[model samples]
Target: MTVFVLVSGLFTGPHVWQETAARLTAAGCEVRAVPLGGLGRIDGLDGLDGLDGLDGLDGKVSDPGAVTDLESHISDVVAVIDSVGGARGEEIVLVGHDYGIHPVLGAADRRARSVARIVYLDSGMPQDGVPALAAVPDQLLREQVMLLAAEAGKGAAAELPPPSREEWRLWGSVAGVPDEALDRLTALAEPQPLGTLLQPLRLTGAVTSVPFAGVLCTGSGSSIALVQARVDFGEPAFQALADPRVTFFELSTGHWPMLSSPAELVRTLLDAAAGRGHRLTPANAAGPPAHLRPFPLDVPEAPVERIGRVDLHLPSGDRPRPAVVLVHGGPVPAEARPTPREWPILTGYARYAAGRGMVGVTLDHRLHDVTDYGRAAADVVDAVERVRADPRVDADRIALWFFSGSGPLTASWLAAPPSWLRCLAANYPIMAPLPAWGRLGSAFHPAEAIAHAGDLPVVLVRAGLEVAEIAATVEEFLDAAKEHGANIEVVDVPDGHHTFETVDPTDATREAVRRAVRTVLGHLTA
Candidate 1:
């Protein structure tokens, strides 16, 4: 039984961790909800002014604002650890959310041997030798934070106060939250000690030895991608985003998953506690439809006639590895692509392939027009040719993995294959055109193409829970391919939806998807 320490971010107290803590406690784990210095307490605020609007403490204002500092919070956490027996006490999992990470790290640095794991929940990891405020590249947001702190206090001990319901919603943490959690957050939130953010973290590199896991809120964007983008834009605070030790996972919710999706958050924390972190795969990039997580690709994107681009993902090795060209699904909703590169679900397979010691290439082709199958097919060919030209790719061993709508695009290539082409993989593919989607030309017939496919091997995966129309189409394609004497393999995934693996919400579905991925990769590389 592991002991769990739950810490909340600025302006929030243990109340914010109520749901998570309760769930953990019920799961037979010892739970401690720690409210850092000055939080959930009225004594520290007695010296600060500007509290007339804060739950009626007009006369309880304090001056000098120096009551709480970073050391105070560190002491608070260390005390909790010691009370439970410190390093010799119990197996402890320290979990921090948002700004709470500062003290969490401070405590971990102090009690490194005592902590079994540290989970960063939608927060930045403190870099050594840098003040938290100094790491903020956005001058305007930094200024706003400081100004809020000043407005809540007197002298140099200024602190930040609770945001209004509207302000909190604007911060993107209120989305998908229940009324109960939302109200509690707005009413119980206390002003935070600013010194925690102003102080530079002290480290002897001891905390690096402790296991670290990051639970990212994908409704906003991927923490890894965001950090990498910041690193590219020259932000030092986010340098640890690429740190190999911090295993990353995604929760398709707002930043406050504890309030928005408490059960899922509980499960994720338990996984981290048990030293079962999310694998560093592209699947960590999965999220809500409009906002999928972004990952750093190994190779640059190749522009394809303003329609889309091709992204290359490479495995680590000295010898050239076989390449897998990945084609993502059909046209996503327009609102989903606020940016051109934000298309959903292509990068995961690339990352998975790379994880399996192979080069993965994912491309974005124009599928916005229902009638533009020709252009989409051409894009696949172009992506393949370009990948085959890469020096690091085994030119003679390139394969293809077509997903969903892009599955049918393999028809042209399958009809008359190149000698170097090894095999083909399709997942929940759309082999025949539906009347609702578009009209198919004579050349797009799966049976006709399979008869001419010769000895080229193909692997088809069917999802059990898929809609009737798609299920029938895949079934018909399988029968036709077999009738044409095409060498083919079919893997059926029960209880899996069309995009079950990518937009995963259950363990069973995710496992099924993983099995399909393994089967596809195995057959393709065979």
Candidate 2:
């Protein structure tokens, strides 16, 4: 007679809850898996079901905002509760993961009379009026997020960025959402509503009166590094639930548990449904998480500041090309050069650019000393000035190609962007300072660069999975340029992230990346 209503976390739909639901059902419990609005395949363009489903809804979709906002999600939870009515609602175990706690609790409050118990799978409890983002503990990411919000300023309500075509692809593989349903999920995904994130939650007494339990994943659920650990550890949430009213299970898994450990995960859910408090002790727990994706990091170079020199990695055919100042991330010196041939990626990008007859330059900026992204940006601007003053640079042919933070810094420096060297190519650019993700984008909110857009052409590239909830930042930057009547082109990279990479990226994926860069270059020449 009891039904179980399950809610998934951010960026996920009801489909992910299927395995657990099926397991619970086999144990004789009725189940209702509810999909959240922005992530599910049924609605919007950024969902997992397919892109076609959300295509017609593009331009009509709303933002996803931050995870703490409960008002919006209340409706998502209530819809399923309403459908189940009185009889089944009485026996429901309302469960949620990660950000799913908000809606699941909100729904139980609204439908208090019909609900049974609430379970959080390593998800933080959504305190009334408290924000979900406030719980994140990563210092660098938090710093970057605050900077983005401050930069966004009054534009907070504007559209967020959409995940690049590549990002969605990567997320599916990493999250175990399956490639077949990727396009639809991406199309259904929406820019989170900023106000919802900022708004305080005031739960009606009815919600807390319901029974509840929680399982917290102590590791990566709190930071990006932890999320990355999933590549090898799988979902860690299931390994830590130890309570009886709510069983706590800890697995050495990644954030996306269902994708990596569905079988053990299913058994746990079923045990909970059967009042068994299922937990994996020493013998039966899932194995360590495994991440097959490869992530690349740029080696630190010497610092450059004021009017001094820096090292930047721009692939323009020949290295040490005569007469070019370079810009780089962190502090790297000219002597700290990394052999291009050694890094297959740098090699590929370099070969492509040089084959197209582009000159190369590299530079570095002061970031280690500065405690904030804004100061770091100033360093980038100074480096560019140095490049301009140098007689070696063919000012007419200067093209700025960068990813992440450098994109906004370079774009901001242009005043009357010449059609040639004035061209801008950026991927996963830190164009907007996102409040929700804290300091993640603080170093280079594209809005800061808007002053110079009138002088040049700008293009933006976004990684699907890496941007995650902060996808809207890209849109705000593009909107500023279009507002100034500047020409702009936007490309969505499939299976892409902060860096230019795919999950086990194949030659085809590499070719796709190459074509994208070349297209941007060709457009500038045109």
Candidate 3:
């Protein structure tokens, strides 16, 4: 019989894995659902003031955060393996979900001789030196998480509180589970210590020898979002999933498959533990392709300067087609690697344009800060000229599509777009510079550029849950453009969040994106 050890994510205890554990045990497997210290049933230090986060625990005692760092969790797992009689070569299978992957990987590294395989269940994989928080692509979101942790624990320690019921519904969990499962999950959930997340897993690259498996929940928005972010940022976290030694499978459910699809989850887990699962490929892990034969742009510009290239996605054609350039959101992170510009959201839109019989162009530009605005505009102009130069492209018909922070940079094109350019479109754009946002202090308003944008045709896509300042500025621009008699179209996504097309995509949001693209392409052809 196989010995299976399971670890849970943030704010969750071993109880979260009860159903799955029971099923595994019924299958004649020995299971140990190990709970991390400070997260479950820790004894002794309970009555200490400011330790209210540990209110429900009823076990032995120790200094919680002080003693329960990364090494402590590793010790807990190693202890379990020792108790279970795990032996070299016939080592046990270790499974981790969500944030639990960190400590699990650490334990596997230390006890490599006693572990046969490591399973990452829709969890973010750890990079050798990049800590969990730093591994997250979105810096703003990272800051917000830390702030919430500090507030929840009354500055006593860095620990995240369980999500409120409403947050669960909006973010992901509610869509995957029955009412009872959700009730139990939330009830048993506890605040996860910050040290686990803050401490970087130190790996010596020797862990690659252990077999690995990943379970991707295709239906979960959070899973899709994390995978997309990792692929785009070229984080090693995504690369780990693609490692040759790793075998992966997909489940059509949400994040908590243990509760949502326990039976199927168990089957996949067993197959993985036995080294009998399918090999995951890029095609299987990612969304469907946008084009059958998209070509990489590698044109050279003045002074042998190879203009930053983009992927040229061609529509079915015996003749030339109109084109649309897709610009993604940014202040791109400084750590982002030099990679191909094929982010799903960008290519997703490009694919939509191809479906509508228009050639699509997705640009690659390096953006480090506010100063990159001028270079961004220049890149757009160069991209247009390069695409126009293509024999398959109609030089006289072109358009631009912008998302998030990149939207404001379109002001230059709108101000003086080429004769071949038809219009520009934006989605939940950060058009006006808010110096108060602090990245670029008070000296970076592009109001004059925006004022000049009134001369061009434009499509504005709005997501309902925007900050007040962004909404107000976008509305102001729309009002002014209307007064200037600019031809404009508006698409409203009332129930959508910013980046809803990826973060928490809905049928409605997808359609809204398509409508915006169609509207822009229609202007170009007209």
Better of 1 and 2 by lDDT: 1
Candidate 2 stretches with Cα past 4 Å from truth are: 18-28, 37-69, 88-90, 138-159, 162-188, 216-244, 278-526
Clashing pairs in 3: 43-60, 43-61, 44-61
CA lDDT of each candidate?
0.67, 0.50, 0.67
Model 2 lowest lDDT segment of ten: 331-340
Tens digits of per-residue lDDT for model 3 on 1-526?
A: 6878887777776667767877887787767777677775433333433222321223433364374666677677767767666443335888988777887888888778778899988776677876666543434445766886677568554665676654453223344688887876666667666666677788877677799887877554333333444445544445555555777687767778888998999999999988876554453256532221222222121111123576787677559989888886666655664432556566667767777788778877756454566676677667777888888888898888887778667666766666777888888887765422223322223333545654567888998876444676678777767666676788999887667676545678767876887689879788
Runs in model 1 lying further than 4 Å from the true structure: 42-66, 86-89, 134-139, 147-157, 170-172, 223-245, 281-526
- Model 1 poorest 10 in a row by lDDT: 49-58
The number of clashing residue pairs in each candidate reads 5, 106, 3
Q: Model 3 Cα displacement at 357 (Å)?
A: 16
When sorted by TM-score, best at the front, the candidate numbers are: 3, 1, 2
lDDT of 2 by residue, 1-526 (tens): 6677777765556655545555655666667766555544443323333222221223322254444245766676787777777652356677787667777777787888777777776565566667654444335533544665566686554223445546532222234435544454455455543333455556787875665554433222233232233222222332233223444455434445565566666665555555654332321232421122332322222222223444333333332322222233321122322321123343344344544544344444544311344565675556656655545444445566665544445544554454435567666665543322234343345665576666466666666665442355676766777777766776666666555542426554565566666665675455
- Output the better candidate (1/3) by TM-score: 3
